[model samples]
Target: MASLLCWCLEAVLVAVLAVVGGVSGQVEAATPRRELVPAMFVFGDSLIDNGNNNNLPSLAKANYYPYGIDFNGGPTGRFSNGYTIVDELAELLGLPLIPAYSEASGEDMLHGVNYASAAAGILDITGRNFVGRIPFGQQVENFKNTIDRITENLQSVDVAQALARCLIFVGMGSNDYLNNYLLPNYNTRNEYNGQQYANLLVQQYTTQLTRMYNIGARRFAIAGLGLMGCIPNILAQSPTDSCSDQVNQLVQPFNANVKAMIGNLNANLPGAKFVYIDITRMMKDILVRPAAYGGQITCLPFQTPCPNRDEYVYWDAFHPTSRVNVIMGRRAFNGDESIVYPMNIQQLANLDLQPNNG
Candidate 1:
C-alpha cells in the first residue's frame, strides 16, 4: 500500500478499480447501547469541525444554505450535508454527538469537546488564506483549557484516569495541502518539495501528538490523509478530467510517515495505544466505485444542490457527501488492517491500557 504511484491517472481509473474489485464493501455502524469509551476528544480540520468556525471571521464557513440540508438541525457548520465522519463515529461509540469547543460547556465538556476548525492545519501558516483559524497547536491549547476546567470540576487527581479511557481522534493534514501548498498565494510550495513538506508536517504533528499523550490521551485513532487528488474539488480542475496524479503523489508520503509515527508512538510510549486509520485506501474505495455509494455533480455558484443529495459522492466542491462520511466512519470503527492498519478502532477501544501506576 505504499503507492498508487504507477497507476494511470484517468477518470476511468474509477471504473478500472471497480471492475478489478480491488476494494469494495459497505460498512454500517453497529449500534451499541454500551459506551466504548468514557469520552472522545476530537481534533482536526473542516472534515469534522461540527460548528467551531461559525463565528470566525474566516471565509471557510459552511454554516449557511444547502450545507446541512440532510442533518437534524440543518446547517450546523458541518462541511457535509448530513452527519460528519466524527458524528457517526461518536454514535457508533455509543456517545452523543461530541460538541464543538466553541459551543460546548458545563456537562458537555465532561464527555468531550471537538476542537476541529474549518481551516486548521499542522503548520501554523498552512491556512492563513482564511485569515482566522485555530491551528492544530491552538486546538490542542483549547483542549488544555478544557482539561484545566475538568481538573477544577472533578479534581486533577481523578482526571488522569478518565482521560486514559477516552478516545483521542484526529483526522487532519488535508488543509495543509488544499489550502496552503497548492495555493498560488502561498510560499510553501517554493519552500519545499513534497517529501520535505510532508516531513515538516509530520514533525510538528509528532510534537502535538506527544503533547496529547503527555496530557493523558492514552487511546488514539489517528486518520491518515485521504485521496486529495480524487476529491471532486481537485478533479474538476484537472487538465485531463481525471484525478490529479500530481496532488495524490504529493500526499502519499504524509500517510506513510503517519503510519510510521503510529508505530514509533506505540513502541516508545508506555501507556498509550495508537492506531492508524488508512483513509487513503478507504477513500480510494469510494472514488474507485463512487457509483456504488452515489453519483457526481458539477458545482455552480448560488445554485440549489441536487434534491437527492444522498446519491452524490460530494456535498460540494470540497467535501464528501454524508453517505461517504458514514462509510468512512464505519471503516475507521471496524475495518481491518488493510484500511485501519496495525489494528482497527474497535480493537483499540477494547484494548486494556493499564495505568502506569506502581
Candidate 2:
C-alpha cells in the first residue's frame, strides 16, 4: 500500500509540472513583438513640414488655428486641417509620431525628428529674403546640432549606424524658383528661360545631396517638382483659371534634370539608394478630372461649393492637403516599378534593411 501511494504522488507532481509548462508556453506565444527598421529623418519645406516652422519667427508659419482645425479640433502646427504625409507614413511604419525637429516639447531622440521648415529651400540663400525665417543650410546645421544634443543626453545606441539606417527625405527647391525666381522679384522667365534654371537647380541639388551623403545618410527620397502651373494660386492669376503652359514647359526640363541626378547618385554610391517621386503626372491627373479627384471645395478662390476633396490633388493654393499627401504616399510606396530606374521610398528602405546579394 505504501509503494502504491508513492507512485500516485509522483504522478500528481508530474501532472502539475506539465500544466505549468503549458501555461508558460501559451503566455510566450501571446506576447507581441516589434520589427526593426532604421530611423526616418525628414527635411524640406511645407510639403513635409509638421509644425517645425511654428516656433520660428518666419512669416511662413502655418501652425495657426485653421491649419490643424481638422485634426483633434485644434492646432498641431501641421499646415493641413489634419495630419501631413509624414505623419501618415510614420503611422504606417509603426514608428512613434516624429516630432517637428523644431518642437521644444516631448522630444525623443531614438525614433526620429523633422527638420523641415516652411519657406526653406535647397540653397542657403533661397528664402533668406523672407522676413524671420530659417534657410535650408541653417536647417541642416540645426539638425546636426540636434543629433549631438540627443547623443549627449541619451547615450543609447551607435549613432553612426543609427544614422546609416535613417531614411532621409528631402522636399524643396520649388519655392526657391516660385517665390524667388518665377515671381516678379526675380522673373528670369524671359531671360535665363526654364531650361537654364532647371540646370542651375540640378547643379545646386547635387551639391546639397553630397553634403548629406558625407554625413552618413545612405537612403534618400527626393521628390521632383510638381505641376506648379496647375496650382490654384497660379490658376487664379489666369483669367480662365487655366494652368500656365509656360510654367509647365519649364518644369519638364527641371524634372528630367532631377532624374539624371538620381541616376548619377546611384552610379557613384553602390550601396546608396536614391529615388525620385514624380509629382507632375499625379498633379496632372487630378487637374484633368477635378470632380473625380475631390479637389472641389467651395472656398471662394477655389470655385463655388467644392466637391469631395478625396479625388482632387491640390489641397490649397500651394501645398498638398493631408488627404492628397496620403494619396501621394501610397503611389510613391507602391508605384515605383512604373517610373524611372530607382524604386520608391518603401523599396529603398527595404533594401537598406535587407540588401540583395546579386
Cα RMSDs of all predictions?
5.7, 17.9
- lDDT (Cα) of model 1: 0.79
Query: Which parts of model 1 are misplaced by more than 4 Å?
Result: 1-32, 290-303
Error of 1 at 146 (Å): 0.3
Return the TM-score for each candidate structure: 0.89, 0.79
Q: Residue pairs in steric clash, candidate 1?
A: none
lDDT by residue for model 1 over 1-358, one digit each (tens)? 0010111121222442343233233223447668888899999998898889889888777787567777889988888768888888889888999999999999998879999998889999878878777899999989889998889888676899889888999988999999888999998899999999999999999999999988878898999888888776676576766678889999999998998988999899888888998888887775666434333444432456555454456667677777668778877888878988778777887888765720
Candidate 2, residue 246: how far the Cα is off, in Å: 0.8
| lDDT on C-alpha atoms for all candidate structures | 0.79, 0.62
How many steric clashes between backbone atoms does each model show?
A: 0, 12
The 10 consecutive residues of candidate 1 with the worst lDDT sum are: 1-10
